[model samples]
Each structure stands twice: as structure tokens, then as C-alpha cells.
Target: MLDRSSARDEVVRLTRDLVRIRSINPPGDELPAAELLAQRLKGFGFETEVVEVAKNRANVVAVLRGRGDGPALMFNGHLDVVPPGDLSTWSRDPFAGDVADGKIYGRGSSDMKGGVASMSVAGGLLAASGEKMKGDLIITAVSGEESDSIGTRHYVERNTLDGIGGIVIPESTSLELVIAEKGTIWLEVNTYGKTAHSTQLEIGINAIEHMVATLHEIKSKWESIGYAKDPYLSPPTINIATIVGGVKTNSIPDRCTATIDLRPVPSQEHPKIIRAMQEAVDGMKGKLKGFRGEIKVINERLPFATDPSSDFVKMAQALGPSTLGLPLDPPFGVNFFTDAAIFATKRSIPTIILGPGEYDLRRNIYLGHQPNEYVKIENLEKATRFYYELSRSFLK
Candidate 1:
């Protein structure tokens, strides 16, 4: 029989084990982490699956079926994390999963392994309790969240969500629930010009100059056009991520390109946004003699939102605060996107983001995706209890 303290220790141990695996995202290889999670799930009587989405990247899906028919609740989290840059800057090994001073330090600790472990342990507890749940409890440790969200997209395409009532994405939110988030689109802008020696400035149109001028115009009006406002989210914004042109300093190159990252609110249609961006570039064609521009969309994802009054939202809102003995913050929006959006938008599943990662002011501990990334064991335990209590009602 597992007592509360023992269960907490188990969750902490699982988190440390997961952190020890190096599942960094540029070349995301989550199979090792997926295998570890699968082993734990299987030991708890879950029917587990290790799904390979790419060469060495895999997602682990574990299911604990109920005896009777009821709404299915899915707990989701990613196994892959952003690369821990410059290891020399870290006080402890980023992959060591070092437990020091009451916290686990590692690259993925707060960004999500803590949340994943909590969800996994919560599912295990439910299975071990032997209570007859009315519905299925699904736990998914997905890959590629830090990059393209390939894992969740593949999972949604293959799995049916007809019977699933809600999804809980245990992304680190410091325990405050996130119900909505912004969408994103990546664009590449290209400009054309004639190549000529630097001495003959008038003989060739400068592609970089033309591109810079066009971007200046776009930046001036970008926020005002097609901007969507929300009580919980900031207005949509655009950032110029990269630019490349010319072969050498002395040449007036024939080609130049710029990459853009645009975040749109829920009301902005992707097609319309693309059109507006294209028009911004095309409008420059006649303005500059012997110069032309083109806009190409590299990637895109939709913003996600769910009815605040839905049974799923109410269920999470009621459970988290009650379990943690803290006042719950109102459901808010986040600027960044997550795999939760994939499930909410693609599968039409009501999804909520709730987990640990809130910065503890007193402890001087910083959050995820940085040097010395760590998660408090107390927060991990609380998150596990929160998921357990929420699942009990939602899966009932």
C-alpha cells in the first residue's frame, strides 16, 4: 500500500529518471524517455504503446480502461525539451537530474518532466486504487513539442477522440490553469535585384535595401491591421527572426531574404493574414524599379480557446485549488503555443494547461529553458495530487 509520502517520493524519483534522459528537440530523440515512461505505466497495469513518429523519436501512450462507459480523460505532456546550451554555465549537470537542496535540476525539469512524472504517477495511483472508474484515463508522453509538435499531430491523426471528454496538458504553468493561447505563423520573405559591382551603385538595385524598406513599411502597420484583442491575451505581434543576402560586402547581390515570426489572435484567419503579408511585399513591386518581392509561409498553427463554463474547465478549476490549498487564479491566456492547442483545435477536445513551473521567489530558483533549470519537489508532489483529484472527477 502506497502512502501519500511514498507516492510523492515515487513521483520525484520518476521525474529524476526522466530528466536523466537527453531528449533535446532540434534533433528530437524521445524514444529513450518514451520507453522509460512506458515501463512505469505498464508496471501500473496500463496498456502502453510506444509510437515512433520519426526515425528515433517516439511518443508513449498509456491507457487504463474503466469497467463502465463514461467520458475519457487524457493527460498529455511532452518528453522532448529545448537544448541546454553552454553546459559550462550550469552549476550541475543538466542531464544528471540532480536532487539538491530539495529540488531537481535539469534541462527539462520545470519545462515539463516534472509535470509528465506527476501525470504518470497520478495515473498509476488511479490504477492501483482498484476503484471502478466510469471512464478511461489516458496518459500520453509526447515528443516534438519544443519544435513542430509532430508527435501530438501524429497522435491526433491516428487516434480517435470521439469518446474523449477532455484533455489535460501538464505543461508547466506554475499551477495556474491556461485555457487559451496565441497561434503562430512562420514566413519567409524574398527580394530580387540585379547583381553589380559596388563601384557602380546606380547600375544595380540593392535587394537588401529594398527588403529593408519593405519591412519598415510592414512594421509600421503590422500591429494595426487584422489585430485581434482579448481580455486575457496581448495583441498579436510580429518579430523578424532572420535575414540573409549578398555573397560579399563588395557585391550588390541579386537576392535577399528575411524570415518572420507572427503571432495571431484567435480571430485572425491564417489565409487572410498570409494575404495581407503577401500584399505588403507585392505592393513594393511597382514602387521600386527593377525590384520584386515574394512571401512564403513556412509553418502555421491556430490559436486555441474553450468555453470557460464547460464541464471540463469547471472540473479543473474546482479541483486544482481544492487539492493544493491555495486560491486558484482565473483562467488566463499565454503568449506561447503548446501541444494542447493541437488537441483542442484538431480533435475538438476541451483542453487545459495546468502544471508546476511558477518561480519561487523565496527559493531563488529560476524556471525552465535556461541554465540551472529546476523544479521544486513540493510543487511536483502538489501537481501529482492535483492531477489525481482532477482525474477522479473528470473520469468518473
Candidate 2:
């Protein structure tokens, strides 16, 4: 059997090792992390595979079989993390895996190398024990979650969910069990116009000017008529994430593009949201003389939410972390998206995001995808214990 102290230490080591790998996506080099994870999973006595999704990037799915026909369980974490933009901004080397002041500090630390480590070590401990649980356990360390879920999409499309019964997404959440996590749909809107010389600005339609007007209109509708306020979560939020297009200031620009991020709950109708945004864009076109651009839906993502009173939620809450070994504050929804939507979409399973890390605020506690990201040593220990009891509870 795996000793608790030994197992915990192993997990800590796993975090540092993973952090050292520099699996930064969007110049995506997740192979190092994926390769290491595949080796680790194999050493832990699970049947593992490393399959590529895009170029050299790969995802690992390791399975441990249980004795009976009890419901199966899945532990999932993404292997890829966002690029650490400026290294000089960090106190230490971002990928150095520096352990300091009761926490491991570096890129991918809390935002989720820690979660990945915890789940990886959980798999190892199960293997070391050599005792069969009540159901099959899948340890999936996927790639590209930070970049667009290319890895997960490949896995989901290629594999069947025949044996899996439920999923546990061990994302960083400051140790609380999250009942609902919002979903995001990435969209790009383009506005077009005619170019003109500086002196004759009116001769050419200013796409930038038209874009500004359309943007204000879109934001107004987004704020007023399109608002969806869940008491637990924020009013369905809209983030104007990016905008570009234009040359020298003297030139009357002919094109402008805007990228918006929308966070919605599962119950909210996503199609209507898309339609509203489209109509809002269409309405602004008539105001411009030479406009030729049209807004189009670029990509879509599903949203999932779970009732706090449900059995699965209660089961998770039973082993959830708290201040004094009692039920903590009521669970809430996160503005971020997780694979919880995949579970909801594929199996109609009631999946809730749980484990360590924070939401709504950027803390070292959750500096995921940023340089100097970190997870507390204490938090990792707590989650390990919690997940152990949670697994045990599943049988009873």
C-alpha cells in the first residue's frame, strides 16, 4: 500500500517535474509534458497511451480497472498551459519550479500544474495500493485546453464513453467544490468601409468609425436586453477581449475586427445570444454608407450547470474541503469554462468543477497561465485527502 506521506511527497515532486517541462501552448510544445506523463502513468501500472492531436502535441489517457460493474470514474486535467509572456516580470525563472515560502512558484503552478500533479499522484497511489476499487478509473492528462481544446476534441471524437459513468475535473478552485462553471463562446466581428485620403475623409467611409458605433450598440444590447443574471453567478458576462485593424493614423482605415468572449450558463439559450449579436451588427450596417462587412459566428462552446441539491453534488460536498471539517459556504458558479460542458453534452452527466484554486480573482492561489503561477503546499495536501475520501465514498 502507498504510505500517505510518501504519496503526498510524490505528488509534490510530480508538480515540480511538470512545471519544469515548459509545455507552453500557442507555439504549442506540449509533447515534453505529454511524454513525461505517459511514462509516469505506465510506471504506475496503468495502461496508458500517448496520441497526438495537432502536430507533436499529444494527450495521455491511462486506465485502471476495478473489480465489479460499479460506475466508472474519470480524473481529467489539461497538460497544456498558456505562454508565459515576459520572463523578466517574474521574481524567479518562470519554468524553474521554484519552491518557496510554503508553495511551489512558477508558471502553471496553481492554475494547474498543481491540479495535474495531484491527480497524477492519485493515480500512482491507487496503483501502489494494488487494491481494486469498485469501478474503473481513468487518468486523462490532455493537451491544448489553454489553446482551444484541440486535444480534448480529438480524444472525445475518437473514443467512446462506454465504460465511463462520471467525471471529476480537478481544476484549481481554492479547494471548494464548484456546482456550476460558466461556458465561453469565442466570436469575431468585422466591419468594412472605404478608404480615403486624410483631407477628404468623408469621401471614404471610415471602418474604424463605423466599428466604434457598432461596438457601442453591441455593448448596449449586451448590457441591457441580453443580460442573464444568475444569483450565484454574475450576470452573464461579455468581455471585449480583442480588437485590431488599421494602418497609419493618417489613412482612413477600410477594415476593423473585434473579438468578444461570452460567458453563459447552460440553461441560457446560446443560439438566441448569437442571433441577437448578429442582428445588432446588422442593424449598425445601414448607418454606414460604404460598409460591406458582415458579422459571423466564429466558434461555439457548450455551457453546463448543476443543481447544488443533487446527489452527485452532495457526494462531492461530503468530501469537499472546509475550514473546520464542516460544510463550508454554499457552492457557486465560476466565470471560467471547464470540460464539465463535455460531460453535460456527451452523457448528460451532472458534472461539477471541484478541487483547489480560486475564481473571480487572480491570486498566486490561481495564477494559472501566468508567469510565477503557484499552488500552496497546504492546499495540495488537503485536496489529496479529500479526493481519497471522495473515492471511498463512491463505493458506499
Candidate 3:
């Protein structure tokens, strides 16, 4: 049996240690955090390797061997945290890992370090227990999840998934079993026009005006198309995130650019959406004079879902209540995407998103990338137990 008190203390300590190490995403310095986890896993008799994805960006892959050859169960979490914008807005140091009111406060504490720590500690405890199982338990602490899923993407590209059966992403899901998530398609649109004096309105085309018309048309076209609704997820939506055009107000702008974020459900196809957007732009060409524009794909990730009836999800549901001391609710979906977009969909592996982060928006708690981020100590303990129980049951 695992020592509950000891595991709780170790998880709290590990969470604090991880928070103190700044692995902010813009510069993505996750090497130190990766090394910390690597060393700890190594101490637990795991075959550990630290793979550097970029300069000062690293991923830690560790495996606790099973007695016989069987499928491996993988647990993945990202080490990178979004930058803490404007430190003055915080009541405590974002990196201090301060403990008060039965909560651990820090930038990444709730977003993921808390989940990471709990899973890591659970793995360590399981290793120490020397309980023989049928398959290996693989743990991956990856980088570059905040900006792009580069670390997990690189891991998928370079590694083989032959022996891995299913994956569990300990993201901030408030311990909910998330079986489906929306995918993302980021697009950059650029419009070009001749530059001239502001007074010469007839000679030079206004690129900003052209961009406005293009956006209106695209929105209208998308809204007009009928889409099938997903039972678990909301309807696919598009947002105009950012726009930049003119350098000077006195001159007609020569160019304008806008970045768009389109989130699609599993029922929607990305290529078709892209085609429709292009068609909208093409239609503007004939209707509006000198409306020259092009669309470029910045990034894309396909949405993924695992059948709730699958054995893996069923097992998770079975273990949920006993492990977390709460009733297991129906499997749900999330709007945000995760590395699972690559890890699960690439090979069609069964995946689940469950973690300790406070996701209930009504509670007015800080979540990922928010100021005054925190994770309740009670949730951390519950998550550790849940991971431990789930891994044990699944690997057996």
C-alpha cells in the first residue's frame, strides 16, 4: 500500500520546487524543470532520458518497467507555463510557490505544475512499491504547450507508438474526465494595395477598407453555412484575434494583415473551412476593385474524441469516485485544445484529460494563464491518489 501522508507531502514539495523554476513559454526555458523531473524519476528506478527540443527547451521521458511485455500506459504533462503578465496585479510572488489557506499559489501551480507534481509523485510511489504489473508506465514532461505544441509534436514525430496503448493528459480539468476537445486553426490574412497620399483617394486602394470588407464577407459566408451540432461541444466559431495595417494615417496603407482563430468541432472538416474562407476572399476580388488578398495557415490541430464506452474510459470512470471521493459525472468535452490533439489523434489512441486545476468558472478561481493562479492542496492530494489508482488498475 502507498503511504498517503508521505505522498501528499512529497507532492506538495515537488509542486513548490517546480513553481520556483521559471519555465515561461515565450523564451521557453524548460530545461531546468525537465532535469529536475528526470532526476526524481531516475531515483525511482525509471529509465529516464532528457531530450532537448530546442535551446534551453527540453522534454523528460521516463519509464517504469513492467514484469512482462505488454502495452504501456502514458502520462503526459507540459512543463512550460505562460508568462505572468504584470506582476503588480498579483498578491504574492508568481514564482514563490507560497502556501496559505490550504492552497499553493504561483503562476503554474494550478495551470499544470500541481497536476505534474501529483502525477510525478504518484509514479514515484508506485515505483517504490515494487508492485509487479503487466505493462510499463511511461511519464512524459514536455515543453512548448503554451505557444505551440512543439515539444509534444516533436515527441510524436520522432518516437514510435507501437507499445503505447492509451494516454492520460493531466491538464487543468478540475479532475473531470474530458474525452473530447475542440481543434484549432490559426490563419493569417494579408491584403495588398498601392500606397499613395491620403488626398489621392481615387488612385490608391485602401487596404484597411478592403480588409474590413473581406472580414465581413468571410463572417457572413461562415454564418450562412449550416453546420451539424456536436452533442458534447459547442458550435464551431471564428474570432478575429489581431489586425495590423497602416504605419501612418496621412498615407494610404500599402498592406494590412489580420490573424484569425477558428475552433472546429470533430464533425467539422478543417480543409473545407479553409476552402470556404478562400472562396470568400476570391468573391471579394470581382466585387471590390483591386481587392488582392491571400490567406496563410499559421497553425492547425485537429479535434479528438475517445468513445466513452471504450475500456480505458470505462476503467477511468470506474476508478474516479473511489479515488477522488466524488461521484463520477458523465464524460464531457472542453473548448481548449491540448497536446493530445497530436498524441491521441495521430495514432487514434484513447486519451483522457483529468487534473487538479480549478476549472469551475462560477467559483471565481484563477485558472491557467490567469493572475493569482493557485491549486488547492486538497485537490492535489486527490489527484495523486486518482492517478495512482488509475495507473495501477489500467496497467494490471
Q: Which model scores highest in lDDT?
A: 3
lDDT of 2 by residue, 316-353 (tens): 77665442153634876777777666555565666656
Off by over 4 Å in 3: 361-366
The lDDT, on a scale of 0 to 1, for candidate 2 is: 0.74
Best model number under TM-score: 3
Assess candidate 2 and give its TM-score to the true structure. 0.91
lDDT value, residue 25 of candidate 3: 89
Q: What is the lDDT of residue 18 in candidate 2?
A: 90
lDDT for 70 (candidate 2) = 83
TM-score of each: 0.95, 0.91, 0.96
| Residue 371 alpha-carbon offset, candidate 3, angstroms | 1.6
Give the higher-TM-score candidate: 2 or 3.
3
Q: Write the residue-wise lDDT of candidate 3 on 1-396 in tens digits.
A: 336668888899989999999999888899999999999889878899999999999999999999766788999999999999999999999999999999999999987999999988889878888888789999999999998878999899998877888898988878878888998989898899989999999999999999999998888877766667876688888899999998898999989999989888997788888898889888988988888999888989899989888999999898887888765558778888889898754688899999998787224343879898999999999999999988898888
lDDT of each: 0.85, 0.74, 0.88
Ranked by lDDT, the better of candidates 1 and 2 is: 1
Error of 1 at 285 (Å): 1.4
